[model samples]
Target chain A: MVNTVDPSGPKPRRALSARNIMLYGTLMVVSMYYLLPLYVMVVTSLKGMPEIRLGNVFSPPLEITTAAWTKAWSEACTGINCDGLSRGFWNSVQILIPSVILSIGVASVNGYALSHWKFKGSETFFTILIIGAFIPYQTMLYPIVILLREIGLMGSLWGLVLVHTVFGMPILTLLFRNYFASIPEELFKAARVDGARFWGIYFQIMLPMALPIFVVAIILQVTGIWNDFLFGVIYTKPETYPMTVQLNNIVNSVQGIKEYNVNMAATLLTGLVPLVIYFASGKLFVRGIAAGAVKG
Target chain B: MTSQSTAKRPVQLLRNLSAKIASIPMILTALVVFVGGTAWTVVHSFTSSRLLPKLNFVGFDQYERLWSTRRWLISIENLAIYGICSLILTLLIGFTLAALLDRKIRFEGAFRTIFLYPFALSFVVTGLAWQWILNPDFGVQGVVRGMGWESFAFDPLNNSEIVIFGILIAGIWQGSGLIMCIMLAGLRGIDEDIWKAARVDGIGTVKTYVRIIIPMMRPVFITALVLIASGIIKIYDLVVAQTNGGPGISSEVPAKYVIEYMFRAQNLGQGFAASTMMLVSVIVILVPWAYLEFGGRKRG
Candidate 1:
């Protein structure tokens, strides 16, 4: 793919000086500002109640212990059970894997059809999906619950998976469609001229070039489906709840005194996978954004 | 010639047929699941459903009740304040971060990653983490008091009036990373000549950002506004995690209200009613926005 520079001249680089020093200094401080809460959470989680009592939140704990993590993983009481969030780990996996796969697959098809085939009402479909993206998931919650009940899938993992896929499809489709539109029309024409069927052209030609975007779609779907709470809580049966639901229960359950350490531990544990994926895929995700897939 | 042409005709026909057939499943799934699901929600809201959805018509009584309820009223009012504050803070912070990073700073990738990674985590965790940090007894207050500032009281979770601001802080942290990316994209899209021209005109950096650059970022602003505004309306998990509508229903939002009534409270009628109102509001805002957004593209 070609990197298109602006037809205009480049801006001359500004030299660094005392003013620059102050600007960069301020920016670094702001970056620290952004990172403060996470730092506080980590340090506090490492401390016992005694050290936490001493305040001085920025300081490393005089004594560190994994006790909070241990409690959060296995001993934290959610309701009547102290099973922690381990029970829901498998449930999140069940929802996350299949939902991402199905949603991405459908999005790939939607993108290809909208971009290449340009069928009647295709633009209308794309427009509707775009609009649908802005409708908060809350607006659809009640009806979705009732619909699931009618289909006998409400309170089931299947219901949750379907809901995730429905919501995931619109943005996923938009991402790929916009990216695919940037690919040369000549490539598609050549494939068609070479007697390639529609699916053949997509599979043999377009799919390989789509790997970068596929990585992005995967990251998005995984993070989104894994982090989802409202849908998981509302649609899936309790046994099938994701880690987010478990974390919510452990953290927000109203019956007793809150355990800040255990709550932070569980929250961090639940978020670990996405955070890992995010750091690992930061390069690709950034490149994907620079591809302008989402820019108007 | 006859054989070749006849073969091509069938192949072409098959290609067209399969394309049409393929779209059927995708289109139908979207229609039956999403559109149909949304329609069912609106219709169910009007009916008197409880725990389980029943088809008994209750007219607009649920809607009437929703308006009169203090909880519903408070939820909307709180959401407005939360949404506006969050939108402004995230935009300002996000734009600053993006602009700063664009200045060819040290470890640009690392800094960007540090800033952007927060967005990848679920709000459930982010909310909980913030909850712990902001809790009066155990969090910042504890630390501050231990440092001998005995009067320090950073406990928004316990106070009703100030709790909403506490919630907005967390939302901004989670959302700003995304806005940063969008703004960065817009910044990178700017024509180099604009910057050169500004420099030639002896424009100060601050003046350039305010006058020349910010105005050019209209698309980015619109994108950010649309995305952020929508998310704010459905903002449930963060508030729940941070405050759980604490201090006696002080922080309740529409989404949480709907959820509570749906299952916990078993007032599904009101749940559906609240949802219906939300959906109507969404449509009301979205229809015009969608038209302006899409209409300009194909026509303009």
Candidate 2:
């Protein structure tokens, strides 16, 4: 193989050049830095208290165990409830499913209307919505509470679902509107000429064609509502606390002996939903974030 | 005559009614929640509302009290420190990583996946993981001490003076990857011919990036800056998770202050005042940027 090489051809260099070494070296260090906490979390979760206390956090467990994960999932205490993250996990699922569906459904229709069936004063409201995205949630927090209380939905899961829909409207609407606007006008016009009304055309032409954007929207909304601590805390009671709020309580609760293993396991459990979505829909997640960022 | 004219007007109004009906949610949100809610908060900030909202109209008293409060002052100061440092460090680290990744390196996807995974997790998870990793007894300090540097002291969660920096480290860890992705996108958008031309002219890569590429990526940088800045202003969960504003309230932030006063303290007026201040701060940052971004576009 070496003899077959032409002398005039580019010379094959050694595998680790100085430039290559530096590039790879820097990347490796940063990657290690990024990976270190996850490693610590996994390792700490696997070790017993004796092992955790005896060794530094970075060490692999001499004795492997799933006790902490089990405790975190089923038996760890958060306040009076001895039930672990499973309660919070189910609560998150309840909130996640509805919030995702309603927000995407409303945003898609809003986007379709804005892009295709523009009426007087629509653009003005759209502008206001986009600008309102930058407004801090604090500005509306108390008022929303009062509004929800007035409607007798305060401290309920439905209230949170409504809040998520209101908040998610701006970004999701922008996503769908931009996506719909990018579709060639002729397709919309063709549907119109064939006597398709607004709902009919939307259901037939737009929904199927915009499935990718729907995926992007779903990814965005699921991660967002799942990871939400502020709304979950403010809108829900102790019985309905989402996974993030419950996880924080379990880890940070002052009354108990600090179970570092259980805390790490709980943390991992709370993060699993979005992590799974992220790893599974890798490029789509990137696309979703990119779409969210560009308009901001 | 009036009835017939009114009937004709209703018919005209019914034109494109489906679009209008579809937009009711956006309209209600924009007008009722956003505009009306902000107005309500600002108005009530002037009142002496205790538990429930009341319009007792005590002009600027809440504001005065808020400014003079020690925790509020500390919170503002921490926000300033955290905001400035997080902004600079995230951009620097993010851009550097992006540049490294942009260099046609091996294992780009693996490296990116590693970096961005933390971002997928919530601030709560990030905070907890870092809190454990930074714990004094069983964490970095202990590890180093075991390695024979017994005097090494690096516990930001406990030290009041440097607690914000501890949070800052975690913040950067979770956030810089995102900035890297955005920066990489900006880098990819640069024309290949620009690099070719620069290479043909014997301009070094570093010099070209510093002198040319950065300036070309101005909009991308601005977008990233706005995103980071907004996030910094609303930084509550991370603090709640990591420090809970402990080390005697050294890591307290504005959002936490607002929430506590509104709910815990049962002082709606105070929360209103604090939230109004947050609104003002956001306006201070947003208006000029918006003007430059949208207004200048219109004028041009």
Candidate 3:
């Protein structure tokens, strides 16, 4: 398959090499492996129930319909309400914006302090937060619920936001701290010599320098907060459910004949935000990961 | 100089006060949120609470009962398997992809983006997609059979023993991107002289990767393992989204079990008891490693 000899001419023929053939073959298979689910999702989403019943999942249905898409968006019964996941879409956005901004803002501040100031017990603070990131949220769930209930915010959007912020602190702090640590310490020292206040140093000196990493933090926090399900489900009341909760209800209903088509569409719709982020800032994330934000 | 000194006085005072007060909020947050919540859970676990958290102390009975529950026992076992398998698979695949991409390949960004995109999508979505892809009659099975390869099959989701592996496969897809990014970063950070030295010594690429490159990336490996380990412990979304603990509760994990007992089963005590066990186990495994890594004195 590789290095086929030329018959007429003195020149060597650049035949299809074995490595090329193997690479192309493997890449095609792997790409298909990645694409299979999306392909099936698209297929099912476009097909009517009659086509779905025909059991040709890989084939385009002879009679295709956008009915499933419309139904999933507007009329599919997710719970007691027949209205689809679109009902909670705004609630998701509201929760996401505040949670992402607060968590990132606080974390960047914490990172600046921990990395630059090196105050007493700052290391301890970082350690506890890192460890907290490992504890299963279920372990903290009962207590958080109790605390929120006692404070009368148990089933409120504010409760959910607070919970997200608290949980987000550990990873975000760790990320920012690690990043800020790698930056030249002279920047902070210079700002200090100029009599920059702590806030002044952070705002005037560190903030401008941290623009790229801040973008990374924004991407991470947005994707995470947007896709979150447990906090949204457990903390927020039904009226303020996120789209994940709605998708969960629709697809994960215990008593129904599960509709694959609607489930796929709903899940895709729920993930659209994170997927957009992935496509948009994916390279930045790669480079950001290289930043060694949590190597310790 | 006098004017400067006078200006510095208020600034110095504020700095001192700020540092003094800096920890106050963090400690308060940790106390009220982490410590207070943990204590509350511990107390509730000892109580005979149900649905709305009744506060009558029952003492170790819930823990005793949780220990005896087959599902709880299975969850612990499942987590161990899932954790180890997911970590290994993610590390292996991620390292390979990272290494491949680091070869200065053409269109490197495209390949890296392809691999990393999966991490952005939530488990709820990826799980659903995987569910359809693995559906015995309608998915990969159907596609292969339609191509006249009727002997092909991937029914792990339906089989209990294999279901964990199924979950592991899906997890690797979603998580390996993170590992890849970490490993790639670590690889790229290597000193250029090492590669030059290897080349001068006439070392092949395979030998170089195994002997030289792998050892140097230990920090990133450590970071990747930590991230993956945490993910393994808290892996509820994917299993719930994909399998729903189905094939007769065969794929049940601790988190899901805790959620079920807490909410649907209306047994908050049992849920907290299971949670306490998970916490203890995590600390047992992680605390020592953490101390060695974070607290121990550095080697020469």
Q: Compared with the true structure, what per-residue lDDT tens digits does model 3 show for residues B170-258?
A: 88778787787788878989987797677667777679889999998776787777677767777888988889887788888998998
Stretches of model 1 off by over 4 angstroms after superposition: A1-16, A53-57, A255-257, A287-296, B1-9, B51-58, B296-300
- Candidate structures ordered by DockQ, highest first: 2, 1, 3
Listed per prediction, chain B TM-scores read: 0.91, 0.94, 0.88
lDDT of 1 by residue, A195-245 (tens): 888889889988999988899888777877888888888888767888999
Number of the predicted model whose DockQ against the real structure is largest? 2
Query: Candidate 3 vs. truth: CA RMSD?
Result: 5.0
Residues B1-300, candidate 1: write the lDDT tens digits.
011234557766676576667666457646665677667777888888877889899899899999999999999999889978988988899898889888766677777777877787788888887877777766677778877899988888889998998888888888788888888878989987787787777677779899999998986887787677777778888887888887799999998998888879998889888887787777775677667677767631
Clashes of 1: 2
Residue B287 lDDT, candidate 3, scale 0-100: 69
**Tens digit per residue, CA lDDT, model 2, A205-228:** 999999999999999989989999
DockQ of each: 0.40, 0.52, 0.38
Estimate, for each residue in B1-300, the C-alpha lDDT of model 2 and write its tens digit: 011233555434553687788889999999999999999999999999999999889999999999999999999999999999999999999899999999877789999999898889899999999999999999998999999998999999999999999999999999888999999999999998797777667677789899999999998898899989999999999999999999998999999999999989999999999999999998998887788688846621
lDDT of 1 at B264: 91
Candidates in order, TM-scores: namely: 0.90, 0.95, 0.87
Better of 1 and 2 by TM-score: 2
lDDT of each: 0.78, 0.91, 0.76
Those runs of model 2 whose alpha carbons end farther than 4 Å from true positions after fitting are A1-14, A294-296, B1-15
